[model samples]
Target: MPPRQQAQPFAKDERVLCFHHEMLYEAKILDIQPSEGSEGGYQYKVHYKGWKNTWDDWVPADRIRKFTEQNKELAAQLHAQIKHLQKSSAKVPKKGGRATGTDSARVSEERSSGAVAGSRGPRRARDYDLEQEDGFHARPSIKLPVPDHIKGILVDDWENITKNNQLVPLPHPHPVDQIINDYLEEERQNREPNSAHFDILEETMAGLKEYFEKALSRILLYRFERPQYHEIRKLWDQAGDDGPNKTACDTYGAEHLARLLVSLPELVAQTTMDQQSVARLREELVKFTTWLGKNAKNYFVSEYETPSQKYIDHARSF
Candidate 1:
């Protein structure tokens, strides 16, 4: 027989058509693993973009081909058709509430079940904690360990936190209250009957503070589990007691706990971190820092940004 055509080298995220069951499905290459046997070649781990995680799989190079311009155009047409079908079939929302129907219900079901579409064999833990038994055994049905508190966060929490009533207001002795009170007191002493004129001012100040604090707290929560936390923890731990990490930790009185909290989100986010996770992380950080003292809390949250932004910018450059 004549020589077979060589498979084209595809990079991660390149579009491709993978043969599964007897059909070709659109997928994106997630990883390329090199072959080690007598017949050297490669295999690909691909994510089926249209079918959700259930359809993700690993296949031999023979099973995949680079997606062409024709394939791209066809895929776009299919996507348009799907969206049209969904709009026509979806149930409209009642009154002021959200739309509910088969599509929405299916999404909710998929989230709760955490079931992948055509998933097979064993699943790997999101955070590979080798010391744990679940991490050691590669069971086909095994799931990443998600904390009870965060399961909802990893899925539906994003929708919940976006609503107007999502974040609860933190109790006031509010951070900026002293200045507001001082202004109000000065107005009151200026004239006994001046209270009425200054009432609006006080109310405005109070409202601004409430909203600011609420947003700030929620913002912190959203960023809590960002990947940057992982890098920070690793560096901080290796620096011992006299470096920047120790100084920051000792200054905040949180010691290594600070590093852990920062890193905790990285692991959790892999399994459960979403918009809701970020919101909750911020709220919790605010609460944690408040307990640590106002000045210390301010310092801790401020320090997180430099490293986090640095990591994000660096990743984007690549």
Candidate 2:
């Protein structure tokens, strides 16, 4: 006779609290399958209660807890913590050019949530720590091989804005959208027009562009860059009816785009993407960042312009 199968703890359609990254979310068990490992276990397919179905995925048994009164309280506490974090981080600095304390936390939250200007709402928090049975796994951290030169660029960008109070001149020579298009064109040249790889490449770039446009103002800017951002907004508003459909991508350049690239791993970790999907995303991101590094001299400005006294005053007043 075949060895007896282990009994499943949770059945299909059961409401449960599912641990995703660090936070626990209310979810429903959609399906259950026996684990393939020699040690008998189960994997559950779960749909997060309020999230889109696209976020549904298989989770291991250890990640699920019964929706008891105790677990429900735990979930509520977690939700409260998320709200507190967002509220605390939402405060922008009024005087400093540097990104410090709450400013950095705000950027992390905005990037993780893909939040754009004036689009604040409840979002998932990924900062909690959870200890597992075998060992301690805090949160899912993605490692992207940002090149050494790219690391240097990030450091310079920070110092120029915070320490030097200098800014990239407006209407950059290679705006972010154009850079993305150029990368796409290069990708297309090497692949068949109808190839699946090319299709994925196009899709990935499109998503990246969307994320950049949404994230630039909310998370990519330093406290000093706020004046420049306001200027761009003012121009867009002044143009009114005749203004072209413009976004941050039309104004900012590779410098800000580089900021977004470095923060992507943290942002990606906050999502419900499966391991395979996350791996694929990391591959594409690494490729794009490498490409960006190669063209840095052309895309990035050699001399950042010093902000005028008026601009400095405006930034300080904010």
Query: Which candidate leads in TM-score?
Result: 2
Q: For model 1, where is the 10-residue window of minimal lDDT?
A: 136-145
- Model 2: per-residue Cα lDDT over 25-74, one tens digit each: 78999999888767666789999888777788898775777797755755
Superposed model 2: Cα runs more than 4 Å off: 1-141, 240-245
Which regions of candidate 1 are displaced past 4 Å?
A: 1-8, 70-318
**How much is 269 displaced in model 1, in angstroms?**
51
Q: How much does candidate 1 score in TM-score?
A: 0.22
Model 1 C-alpha lDDT per residue in residues 136-174, reported as the tens digit of each score: 122221111222323323223334322221321221122
Error of 1 at 242 (Å): 93
The lDDT, on a scale of 0 to 1, for candidate 2 is 0.70
TM-score versus the correct structure, for each prediction: 0.22, 0.57
